[model samples]
Target: MPLCFQELVTPLLIDGAVSPLSPQSPLSASFTSVLPYHKDSGILSEAEAKKAQKALADGNLLEVVFAAIETLRRVPSTRVNIAVTGDSGNGMSTFINALRGIGHEEEASAPTGVVRTTQTRASYSFSCFPDVVLWDLPGMGATSQSLEDYIVEMQFSQYDLFIIIASEQFSMNHVMLAKAIEEMGKKFYIVWTKLDMDLSTRMLTEGQLMKNIRENILENLQKTRVRKPPIFLISSLEPSWHDFPKLRDTLKEDLSDIRYHGPLQNLFHAYKEIINDKVTYLQEKIATNSFQNTPGMRDIDDLAECLKTYRLSFGVNDESLQQLARSMGKESSEYKAIMKSQDLQAVITRGWKLKCLTCRVMKMFLILLSYIPSLDALIAPYIRQEKHNRMLEGVAEDTMTVLKKVLKDFTSS
Candidate 1:
């Protein structure tokens, strides 16, 4: 590591961020009271405080603290860091990109390729939020290493989940990874890749294929001595092909609630709430303060500035939202009912009501120009008038007005 990077990543190698936490440290307050485990379940909660206590009590306070900090200090986004590993041509990279909502197989949103990709643990963050990284790791094979080495080296517990990719039946490698993850009390799932290829061959119907896949997963788990195993069937080409939403829901459900979900959500909520509380407190103080030497004029100016900032932040600008809504339409599909209604109106009314308004505005502007009183004197007789400029401006303005109307009508109706 470079000198600067060494300083930056030193915290990750130590215990979770709690070991060096001083009472006055910037991030200390977050870990002091909170715990990683739940009160009722006694499992590590998401809160840094509780995890820190666990570390201290176990005499491995440094490790837990570092881990907690790593989780908390992690980019403020839901990146489910999944280590996807399977045999060659299994489509692990393609699956990752699809899950993150990227485009085609070759032009995946996540990084992948056939260069023995991901020789080391490399993270591919979601475009929506870079913090949600997916790790494309080296495929599993028979190497002279114990399962414990795999668990520790990979830091299995730090990941939100594990996605074991396989094209056909869950293989021995997948079974080993799954069993190890289970033993370590972590979450893992099997993703059956290349389903499209199988379907093309007419080997089995979709339903039959799914049943066989499930049975194979069970068989693999049994072979590995795992009692029960959870599996997800997926095709990167069709991220929404089969139970994608269900898969997402299951992962969220399995996370350490108090430590991962509850504390994370709470931290964001609390940060916002604290800022709000401070604003309320200041308002009360101002209201109760004596008028003398209070600099009321300055206060009024500050209040106006504050109100302006608040309005800009919270109050939606219909114009901007209309533009955004139109841009969004380019990527997203609109409701059939709404699209049908608009198309009908466009046919009957010659595009939209705003088209009429546009015509009126155009006619009015032309009428004003007519009053220029120059008649033929203002222009050379050979300079023929062209409606192109007027038409272009009118079309642009009309489009904006139509977008606004569409947005308003949809929101209201």
Candidate 2:
């Protein structure tokens, strides 16, 4: 039987556009105008009506509802939903709070000390674009349900990345999670959190502990029969400023070029870019406000400082980028090529940009020499030239080292 154009087009049109309007609104007259086109296209069919009725009975309308919601979330106004899960006290909440630059251990928003925390999946979001949403899922190993049923109920694979966090040793649950991820072909990371605790613990030597944990993690993977796994250790309290940067770099290296064409680095990138533009605008505002009354200027200055701090919350900074570049070297660019098919020019451009930025920041330290500041202007220029040359050389050396290390790691792993 031929389909009913009237019924099909009615639902799609309502879902796509008219649903957002009030039902009582006169604009519904426009919906009436389409009936003639529907009649011309075959106004109705018994099969289409039956399927529609079944969909309603099954409460399948949410497919369209969620389609609308997803479109909304992708807009700059709505929050991007990111789910983070792990064992208790593994710094999952801390990481999310820190991602927003909020003090995770503070009174209200503290990451720890809360009893019965995050029993079910709950969302926390900020007002910013690619607005941030951090969902804390219930800890695993507590529930006795089968893994397949649990995953089906929670829709676990919908997340961008499944963060598997642990402190001392990886558990069977971690192995199970990894196996499930492998079977389902999902992206995941082994985040070895609480490095600082291990470092400070009197019971175990830090080096041995780290080694044993890595081995256990590998053993766990073998037990699950996973072929390749990448693991990282993180200290939420003063995370190796360098280590977290490397993780961020890794995330960038792993995403495909298609992912980059839009806002990259999760939804946070959208928020980050929006905040950057806002910060730039506010800075200009402050400059203007400074020329106004003194009290007004002070208030503007305070607001500006607050916004600047928020701008820094997402872990975007020149220092971190520079350190990551130095540690990663040219391998960073090579990884970009492999993941995104980025050209050599793009790689070199980033290398030179980081190299220049590092030198620029370091030049600030040269002011301390101003006390003796005895270096003549000529000598200063010569020193600058020497520094620039060294910077370029360092970038080149580091790039090669990182490239070799990444290739070796990839092949060996």
Candidate 3:
């Protein structure tokens, strides 16, 4: 509210940097476009986008963004889990072996057989997804298990994706499984096994047979909520042929979604929400004189301490930045060199106070104006509240700027 603070903030209180941001704002445009909904940001599909949105809704906004920022540094070690499920003798285990590029009967390969080889659930790991685990769940028995029970027993929620193995026909059970998985709002793939057999059968041409199989699956799923899911027809024995390579390619694409894309999408949404929430809270305080209850912020000069508080909360303090630099094997100057948040660190100084003191005309006028009785009661506190609100906005903007730089460095690295 001090006349000198005009240098740091706008004159109008409404001209805050952190307003309830609209999508069209410059700040919003600098980040991901998938906040309220998904836009093809080269990462999130409709399904992954929904999962990210759910994660945002269920989590602390700032925490979600910060965690995602941290994840950028740990992507190599991040894990993604996949579940392979099917009816007994339907080649779920064979598909797992093929998908992992491990031949049946090879070391560490999933056991395969005509009977239920995977009686209890078995997990497989490959160097392809370092920390990844693929669980070959016990088969959904032929008319023996209920859908509800199958869902619970498999613990479907733990896996990021489900591969439902089908063969010979897309049976009622297969359609039901698809419906249930789709209903649960899970991402899945329909992998039709033994396409080699279908091709060798003398009934139809290979293309015609494949088309017929796809149509049959689609026709049976018409009444179900399972939309056009990624369906792959492959021979589990011939990993190099059919949809096996394409399936692996899809995994490559989606695994990135699992780690970075969807979470990054949520990060943007939450980041905006955090900015809006901070702005709204501070603005409400300005409206109610509630910041008068704030301890130690006795005057605008005490803003040094206030800025310190903001720095600490946003992890943009000198110490925190230096620590982060050390963690990244870089100099603190590297991050500080580009950070506007550094404004808070040296914001309050003797030179700054001297400059304010030089504005004697405004001070003298304030002095004369102080004698205006009831206006005197209003003037000082109003300025003080205005200063606090602007300081809050400045700190919030700097924090977001720091996050942006961190994200930039992360992506470039």
Most accurate candidate by TM-score: 3
Q: What lDDT tens digits, residue by residue, belong to model 2 across residues 77-167?
A: 2233455666665667776554444565554353454454655676665423233455677667547777777677667766655667776
Specify the highest-lDDT model's number: 3
Superposed by TM-score, candidate 2 places the C-alpha of residue 236 at a distance from the truth, in angstroms, of 1.6
Ranking by TM-score: 3, 1, 2
Model 3 misplacement above 4 A: 1-71, 261-266, 277-413
- TM-score quality measure for candidate 2: 0.41
lDDT per prediction? 0.47, 0.44, 0.63
The window of 10 residues in a row where model 1 has the poorest summed lDDT is 1-10
Cα lDDT over the full model 2: 0.44
Q: lDDT of candidate 3 vs native? A: 0.63
C-alpha lDDT (0 to 100) for residue 124 of candidate 2: 63
- Pairs that collide in candidate 3 are none
lDDT of 3 by residue, 5-70 (tens): 011111122212322211122222222233355454233345544443433333222333344554
The 10-residue segment with the lowest total lDDT in model 3? 1-10
Cα error of candidate 2 at position 22, Å: 54
Q: lDDT per residue, candidate 1, 195-312, as tens digits?
A: 7776787678899988887887887688768866567777667666675656765544453231245434443343223223323333343344322133322343233332222212
